[model samples]
Target: MHKKDNNIDIANDRNENIPTERISTMFSFGMGDFIYEVFNGIFGAFFFLYWETEVKLDIWIVTLAYVIFAIWNSANDPLIGYLTDRPNRFWKKYGKRFPMVMIGTVPAILTLAAIFSPPFLDPVQGAWIYFAWILITTCSYELFFTLSSLNHYALYPEKFKTDRQRRRAGGIRMALALVGTAIGFIVPPLLIEYENRASYTNMVWIFVIFNLIFFLSLIPGHRESNYLKKRYMKEKEEQKEQISFWDSIRIVLRHKNFLVVILIFFLDSIIGVSLTASVQYVAKYVLEAEAETSIYILAGFILGALISLGPWLFFSEKINDNRRMLIIGVFLNTIFLLPFMFANDLFWLVIAAVLLGIGGGALRIGRNPVMADAIDEATLNSKRHLEGAFMGVYTFFNRFALIAQGIIFAVVHELTGFNANLPNQTELAKFGIRLHTALIPMILTLIGLIIFFRVYDLFPEKTAKIKQKLKELKL
Candidate 1:
């Protein structure tokens, strides 16, 4: 029988005896971000561009695919969280999250490959074929993505066990994710020609190989310990009654703090996906640059982010306030993104990208700690461990970013008379791309930040109480 030790002071405890080991563990854990961001960077940055431009799929068909895909994508998060959040035979041996993470990862990568490898077909006559391919492959990717990534996210608050550790882990994670995202943006332009389907397929295969290598590396970080297994088993026994999935979701939804966090998460998701997806258009239509020139522009953005991270991490540690750090990041990102609309040359464009990255970096560094804090509060209120459930709902809202992006593009493109068939866009269409690239995302991010600032009340003092209570409950 596993006994819950109420006296374990996880909040203050530190592994001072083996500092090297602790750093290694945190680095390994952060490596998972590298894997996640590579796929996200590649997929988000190029998926729409590939289908609409390269595959010559109609913009309406693309948007329709996104809508249908979002339905399945959003639907699975809570279900996967609910189903996998229970104790099973694997709990004692393999640990709960590790197995789910493992199960979801490889298949997701394979499906991502499938998404880029649609059969050669005419865009006009074979529209449905492309639509079916996008729907099936993207939905399949989302299912595995939610399974692996949600559990991985749930693992954070569980494994880190304290605010200081979470902040440290978050900085490292964001740093690696930035590197992966840079590769996603930079590599494609270097390898892909706008007209070559084979180049896109080859790029994805390279990503597949890169993803698998990093996948193997992340296994060490995700390995569960005997202590974690025992603690999970004890928590399971204390659960007493398992609520229905809908009820569980309602409980999480009713938590005001968690809801606010997810709303902000939803908006940020929109900003991230839209900005990445619009990069190629901005480079080609707006800047009139070659395919490879996009790499230099992306390099500026990524470089700014990577360089600014250390300062942001230091500031986060100094303030010890995730909420404030996040707010500042949002404000800066919003302000900086406005320049994208006015930047005419490649130099000015790269400068805007850099400024955008500087602010965005802080937001990236601060979000996980803030989210973990919210989850801590929710768990204390619910009196059960449901990180998986919370992440499920959180991710569900996040997937709506795709839908939002799709709609924004569909409406804007149709109204502006943007033509995928044409080599050069009209001035109105160029303006539309700029709106999708910067203006819309900037407005959405600002709105989210305002709402988050006004409604969210989880300050340091309140979070300290939540952490103390969670520790007292041995959760």
Candidate 2:
């Protein structure tokens, strides 16, 4: 059964059941977030360079490890989403999400560190170390990331059962998160002086400390569940069956829009590569600013945070009606990105960064809440709570983009023979440095816009009507 989509007349909805204090939890996540994403950028963008230059890992091994992680991350993303969403037995003694959240942090931090490391001491020794960390860290990352977020976000209904209220809450939280990223993106530029990349331990420790704050601060107001126990007790009297894994997939596939949404997410992520990877690329080639990329990247996130913190509170988002917001946002962002190729001045770069920030802001503010509304639409009609399954499907779709970026980046570097530390390389290697940051990401974003417009409904009016009807059905 879908449960209640609009519990308006029930006198007490899930949102009302949530304790008033949970609202404060949102602020905790923002304090140092951009740092982790920035860290990821450094790790992802420069791990190859780091390995190539500092630790001197084999390119073949590095490339292979990238492939392994790409494939692994894709498969694991939704698998865990599915597991976490389902009513589970693990939540019993484990105290719902707390145990999962607790277990995940250990590996997440460790794996994050490992992702940048050499495999072992010698070529073979380094390879072994790298591979070991990769596998352990990957699992830890997925488990904790999914566990913590799923538990945290699952509170949306509990926080505000009304559609409009949910959107508002989501918007506020997301805005804070972006701002946190902004803070995260802004400060690190000063800490990291990449000419001394070999001795960036100070910068690394700084990030680790902030991330620890993010990790530890989460404990305060997060809600718990005897949810597993509740599920078991309820299911015994209700369906008396666990959803088969195959049944779960079948249910998601049956929802046409749900499947389409997954495609949209995958497409978004792919095109997103251009946007996400651009900071590092632009800094190197255009600004000749290496680690200082964090400054500009934070600038974009801050811009996005300010602009995006708007629209999430309404039951219906207007973007679907005109979609000028997304289309124009992305178009301007792309046009601005192209300028890096021709513009010689820093002013143009700043302007372009701001433009990309606008589009990026729209994306941040709009994407997830819309997905939630769409899933609600599906549930009210299909009469099944399909959130877990849809997330699973979407995670599966995202892997391709991840793999494509890795391969493309590797090829580009190999071809350019991009010197990580060019003491006195010619102007061409300098160009190679620039290409590392932007060339591919720009192309990816353009294609992403085309894909998003082609397949997605900007705002389905049906989303509103379904919630309305569910109010009548008490579902």
Candidate 3:
């Protein structure tokens, strides 16, 4: 039997005619990308570099800190997800997700600055202090970021009800995200000279302010529609079984499509961290370029991503299959990245960056829509509104990328005998940098592609059924 309430004919009540104003307002939410990507870019690209090189901490110490941070992230993200997914009395007044977003903004800003500004101490004392600080600051940052970001992510499937709408909004969102990523990559190195702590701290201040401004800009766009709220409340009233937190995790893990998506995300996270973390090293060590020269290489990649978004969107639509498009994108990205393993000249590296960016665009554009499809499918099967929970788990596993990154850095540095204090690295160190930049990521991408082909089954027909079920449920 269909769960029905009040004979309100909720399907008829839906605002099918999404207003132009609403679309514009909703799309403006992409501004949140500035906050998301800037922090992500800074952390991924420079955090290790700053700590190990500038602060003069042992690389192994830095690696251990991140491992602990990853554990904290894994624990907190799902807890936050579970908490947010539950029906809240207070959320009724302000909206479920917005309050979390609001509460998190200030703390996020403060912690971001704190991560960059460690107090003065001797290297041994500072290492311990930095370890403690990293743990505290990272947990604080992830808590707020997960609260805000998971909600922001949940809003996508709710707001953009149709695939077409998702595609359009997602394109704009990815474009803005890449732009922020570009700025995050290109601007930081320009700010921090080699071993210059003061300049690095100054860059942190600048980024913190930028994060505050962009995060606040999301306030207006976070308003939940009355229709969605009423629907959720009615569903809550009609819910028969209340699943426990562990059950939710179990269910998410058992979800075949979600597993596929998570694995893809997991692998992609490695690729992302590898590139962001290694680009500066590649420029400085392998190419023997100036510190600021990495900016151009990163810019080439991001600019290519920005330029290629539209075409990727067009091609995905033309192909009418996101999964296929994603496979092609990943394959091509790997292909393009292969050249980077050997490219020592600035010109060739820039060329490879552009091609990789084009492939990156394809990968970026398809991820959200595909994930939304998975969430929709899971919701239909489970009869639960678990976007928060799902995204939480999604992010939880995604944090493994950082752990993997730490391991990569520790192992590669140890193997290659990379010493930050050295005036010049050995050829082995350069080779390790190249491996992180290209070879490892390419290998991971291939593994991801193999898994994707073997497991991911969210083709057009499956998505159509999911959408049809949602329609019947008046969701």
Clashes of each: 0, 16, 0
**Candidate 1 lDDT tens digits, 295-414:** 877898898899999999999999988899888887887778899889999999899889988988988888999899999988899888888899999988888898999999999999
The most accurate candidate by TM-score is: 1
Report how far residue 360 has shifted in candidate 3, in Å: 0.5
Model 3: worst 10 consecutive residues (lDDT sum): 1-10
* Cα shift from native, residue 61, model 3 (Å): 0.6
Greater-TM-score candidate between 2 and 3? 3
TM, every model: 0.95, 0.78, 0.94
Q: How close is candidate 1 to the true structure, as a TM-score?
A: 0.95
TM-score of 2: 0.78
Candidate 2 per-residue C-alpha lDDT over 1-475 given as tens digits, one digit per residue, 9 for 90 to 100: 1222222222334442322223454454332233345444445444554555555556556667767766776676567666765665554555444555555554565556545443336645557676566556554555555544544544444334454555455565656566555544566556656555534445555666666666776554343434334543454345456677777777667765556556555655654553455455446544666566547554754674476446322312554432334455455555555555554555666666666566556655555555666567666766655455566566667666767766766676677665554534455655654454455556666676677677656354766677667656544
lDDT of 3 by residue, 1-475 (tens): 2222222122322444232224555556676665678778888888888888778888888889889888888888888888887776565556677677778766877787778888877878667887888788877887877777878887778767778878887887887888788878888888888767778889989887777777767777666655566656776677656668998888788788888888888888888898888987887677766679999889889978988988889998898887787788778777788988888789888988998899899988888888898899898988777888898899899999889888988899899999888858999999898888888878987888898889989899889988888777766
Ranking by lDDT: 1, 3, 2
Better of 1 and 2 by TM-score: 1
Error of 1 at 29 (Å): 1.2
* Candidate 3 deviation (Cα RMSD): 3.9
Model 3, runs deviating above 4 Å: 1-21
Q: Candidate 1: misplaced stretches above 4 Å?
A: 1-21
